[model samples]
Target: MAWAGLQTALQLIYPPRCLTCGGMVESDFGLCGPCWRDTPFIGGLVCDLCGTPLPGVDDGVPVHCDSCMTTERPWQQGRAALMYRDSGRRLVLSLKHGDRHDVVRPAAKWMAHSARPLLREDTLIAPIPLHWSRMARRRFNQSALLADALARETGRTSCPDLLIRANRTRSLEGLTRNERFATLMGSIRAHPKRTALMEGRSILLVDDVMTSGATLAAATEACYASRAREVCVIALTRVANES
Candidate 1:
């Protein structure tokens, strides 16, 4: 009863606001109705490999997208919470560059829902690693934050430093698929000290966004090299159409 009273008092002092619009919302870490409608939360049929939304209904059978058909994905399966557009884009950029730590909780909830199919008793959660130089500039890895929060929500073990960026690579902003793959080919590897934790475990790699999936491929390969029994991936958002 004291806690309830305290919560009521706190709500009076600091009312909840929408995550994207800053409009008053009923609860914390939520979007206003308008923003929620605008956000492209992925659902229905999706690619079995990368989680891109498909045109048909989910028939209880896994299907691949056009991109996944031609391109190779190192991970066994994947899922994403949103399409990288509209409010989804805004949310990811805010978390990545604007230091919006509050976004982690809600984002992790969505990711956990999307990743329900991929979870296992022996699963270990890890993030796509950032280069030390980049980490120094950014101060935090958004992916790691998401992975840790997701682990908490899913009742799984999280290893934030399971993967390390062995080589510093340039940004992949404008790189083609081939170039992006080439740049990240040997850039990521499993941490020597954490390799034992991954052995015979199903690794669930988390990332803030999936563009060309080059980074995820690198991270998945690293997990495989560490003798992980299987690897699956989840992302906060995915670029619907790769250019």
Candidate 2:
């Protein structure tokens, strides 16, 4: 009843709008008709390794992206909720840079849905850490926001500090694959306090986006170093362009 009243009060005070189109929304997270039809829900047969769409397949062959086939990934498996396209990029930017807290719930709900099949019953969820300098400026970490949203829906505890950013790296927008990996190699360190909790635990590594898989791999190495038995990766969006 209290939660219902809170929702009602919020709705009365602030008319909800579709996050994508800015059209009037009847209920919270209810997308406008156009947006609903247009939103790219990632479904169908996807890469068994990274969850990206594949053009051709052979049964018994391990499904993975060309990138994953060439380079080793520290995390056991990775899944993305959406491809890095207009709608996917915009949604992440809105919640991340724009500080749209309301978008977190729907975004996280979608992530949780995609991850449900892969999630272990006794898994520990952890978000990628932001460098202290970056967190200080943004006043929040987008990965932490996504993790919190998932925890609420899944009834799991989110440990945000399982990995800590040891140093800040340059923006990876234009970096080469080798360069990105080199930059991320020692950037993350496992937290000493949570060292015991990580041992033998199935860990789900959460992040807002996955570009080169470099960052997540580095973080997973840290978790593994701390004795985590298994580490899986989940990201909201992933860069799909090969070139």
Where in model 1 is the C-alpha error above 4 Å? none
Most lDDT-accurate candidate: 1
CA lDDT of every candidate:
0.95, 0.83
lDDT of 2 by residue, 1-243 (tens): 999999899899988899898889898876788887776666655665566767764464557777778878777777888777778888888888898887788888888877875588778899999999999999999998898788888887789888899889999878888899889988998988999989998888888888888888999999999998898888888777643
* Cα error, candidate 1, residue 161 (Å): 0.4
Q: For model 2, name the residue pairs that clash.
A: none
Worst 10 residues of 2 by lDDT: 53-62
Per-residue lDDT over 86-133 for candidate 1, one digit per residue giving the tens place of the 0 to 100 score = 899999999999999999999999999999999999899999999999
Cand. 1 Cα-lDDT: 0.95
Weakest ten-residue segment in model 1 by summed lDDT:
234-243
